[model samples]
Target: MTHGFRVASLCLSLGLLVSVVACHDNKPAAETRPAANVDVINVALRDVPVVFEYVGQTESSQQVEIRARVNGFLEKRVYTEGSLVHAGDVMFVMDRKPFEAALDAAQAELAQQKARLVTAQANLDRVRPLAAKNALSQKDLDDSVGQEQAAAAAVEGARANVIGATLNLGYTTIVAPVTGLSSFAKKQDGSYIDATNSLLTYVAKLDPMWINFSLSENEMLDLRTQTQNGTLKLPPIGKLEAVIVLADGSIYPERGYIAFTDASLSSETGTYLIRAAMPNPTGSLRPGQFVRIKLLGALRTSAVAVPQSAVQQGPRGAYVWTVDKDGKAQQRAVETGEWNGNDWVIKSGLHPGDHVVIDNTLRLMPGVPVKANLVATPPAAVNIGGPDGGATGGQQAGAAGASGPAAANANAGANAGTTAAQPTAASGASGALGEHTALYFASGSSSLDAQSADALAAVARRLVAEPGMRVAISGYTDSSGSQAANQRLAAARAATVRAALVVAGVKIERIEMRKPAQIVANDPPDKSRRVDVMFSPAAGG
Candidate 1:
């Protein structure tokens, strides 16, 4: 009986242990798992100022090609190459000895003709009186009259020749027609200049620089659609303000206005060209420079925006995490538009009063419980710091003492909704010097776009700062065109980059050119049209 009681107690204990384990397993998951903590903002509609940015090239308001008007040997180049020249400034001098001799000969001929006219007139007066007195015949009087008339005509012709010769002499001294920047002399001193090879140089007016940019057909259509739907409001073309961001990310101090827009699209590029005129009293802006153009005075009415960090890209498209009425995390697909400072404009997939998760989004999943900490909505408008001072359409006040577009943009990102720290200009330059910088080009074109120009500018600055650094440049082209054409284009693109670097004060010896290999067949055309610049230390030595 003692053994039986022990077995029964043992069995009871074993049963209790199993029941305890099962009870632990059956406990509700809600009590074990905690809701994800996230920062959220309630969506609302407001009018936001929209700033349109484009890569534009600076052009001289008046670019004139200086050429010789008369044929002669170039004797001397008077003006310095690449120097500013005023209107009526002597630029070149041709051989003047020949023209001077011609003028003297013509004058002497005129004098001789005048003397003959005087003599003929005297003889005619004698003949007329003698014929009236019957000492000479009527034919004699007529002959004398004809001689005087012929002499007078010869004198007139000689005088015209003298004037022509004088004008020719004046043409020998070539002068600048406009006050502007002068280019290198095409014909050197002692070089023969003729009608076929008469181009001397160029003069580009520096004041009131023109900024040219193009807009694609798709972009125009989308803008029109937005306007028709009451989503976008644009100011009058003349009232639209323009601001330029230089290659170094500095804003041009002077403001500009929209000067022109093409009525028809270009068949070659399939885009419409737009131009702006910016005052350049200091002559800081030059022709053929790539710059960023910002067009302000437009607004997006009743639009929803979220911090750029809130938007995440997925396989389907861009999406954001949102909180539902039941406090569960749900993924919402959204259509995004242009960026206003640090905030992104949302075109669809969100409604007013919806909760958007701005932080701790990585821990979110469909139907997962979340603890939403409500936060203030991002600023409606990015303070661009222009003529209006952010007064139009809910633009926030710009940072105090922020000058130029770079400073204003930096402040805008800070105050609007930027979550990450930005690198300073010094740090950015250092980073650029340590890596391979790429400059892209348009299809079948060797011209550098604004972004490429900016990159090259940075590279040039680095080259200037570090004397030991050398650069290796390589060009590429797509496989769509003929192989020969592609090869030529690649070479041209590389040459263009090298020229730009030289213009930026980089020595030609420090730059190494590399021949481009055939690009992969599947590479995108846009990706293929590029020039890569790699910097190496002590390579120059």
Candidate 2:
């Protein structure tokens, strides 16, 4: 009787579990899952700016080698090594004794030749009258005339020698051929500078720096193909702007233009070499620095683009979620090109009027119903690697309001729901003086560029306006070259800043030169090579 009761209880429990399962399965799909809320943007075709990036190297437009014009002992180095030197600045002084002696000898020889010419003329004067009267033979007069002419010739040659000697003497004092940054002296003091070892130093002209970059064959071909098919439009070569990004991601303030392009590709690198001329009036940029070059002013006409966040990577390839006409989420694969600011350039797989889901994409799946809200599309501007939508290394191009009827229409459509705000300056004079300002230097150099000098001038003006204001300067250097050299360079950089401030009317006593903080070994060269100037109101601080 107990076993039969237990079996009846088990059957009743199974029936209740089955009934619960059937009720759950019978529920509507709406109760189980609802549509995902997503923010979508209507895709549009418009002209988009493209920036072609390449690794470039800085070079001096004029790199003059300072070599000895005459062989002599290097008496002394007049200019400091690795310093800014003006044109005609004395760089080296060779031993003047030897050249002086040679000049003296030449002058003495010239005087002797003049004396001989005088004597010869006197003899001819006497013989010419006697020969006309037949008092002396014609041979004597002829001989006298020949002697005078020969002596005159000797005098002319001697004068030429004297002039040459004077030039040689002047060569003993080596002056800079051009205004530029000088290099280390190759021949030290007291070293014999001969023809084989005449290289004394070199001076690299800093203003109007040259930047060299290259393009591969494939890249050129692709660009040509696009241009032929009316897909890419390039501005005039001269109008195409070039901007450089330093190693630490800082944009060079100056912009350059394309200067030259090689007709034939380089056989060695198998690439077409191109060069840009940057006006570096401040001498901030040095030769041989590898920087990123961005060439702007190219446009991709009728190109489709989407926000970077909208693009997703899957096992197959890059894809984006789009809302279809049925209000269902559909996965569309996309071929993406380079990044245009915060947006990704969609090469293919998208069309105009397509509602691409920019937000709430992660929760989406194919065939899932989505509640889509239209959002304004981002402006097509090149603002890569910048915080404030400004181009970090290049000028902002292809803005929504850029010239063209198509671009204007696209701009209007994209900004229909939003109002753009203008950006204001971040800091003013009072605010700038309260914080530290960094002055960056070129590698292994202590000379202040135009920008640095301007910064110091501002600080000087502030200090003059406020009597209680004081400044402390600290210098730093990268781990390149030698430790001793780096230390010296750092100290020199600090001293340069301090000196500039004093020259700008800031009291020397109010300025303090602080030791640089310890730098990491892996720090970037651009970040390491800088002088920090901190302002204070306290005298001791």
lDDT of each structure?
Answer: 0.75, 0.74
Candidate number achieving the greatest TM-score relative to the actual structure: 2
TM-score of 1: 0.61
Query: Which regions in candidate 1 have their CA more than 4 angstroms from the true location?
Result: 6-42, 109-159, 309-332, 355-378, 382-513, 516-541
The residue-by-residue lDDT of candidate 2 on 1-541, one tens digit each, is 9999999999999999999999999987675587899999999998888776554667899999999989879999999999999999999999999889999999999999999999999999999999999999999999999999999999999999999999999999999999899989888899998899999889999989998765545456656767899988999899989887775567889999999999997553345667899999999998756555678898888889888899999999999999999999999999776566767788789999999999888899899999999989988887534222332111112111122333233223212211111112212222333456667777657755534433444454355445677877777756656878788889988877775555333567899887665467676557677777776785343
**Where does candidate 2 stray beyond 4 Å?**
1-39, 119-145, 326-328, 362-376, 384-541
Tens digits of per-residue lDDT, candidate 1, 135-165, equal 9999999999999999999999999999999
- Model 1: lDDT of residue 462: 54
When summed lDDT is taken over every stretch of 10 residues in candidate 2, the lowest stretch is 417-426
On the 0 to 100 scale, the lDDT of residue 326 in model 2 is: 98
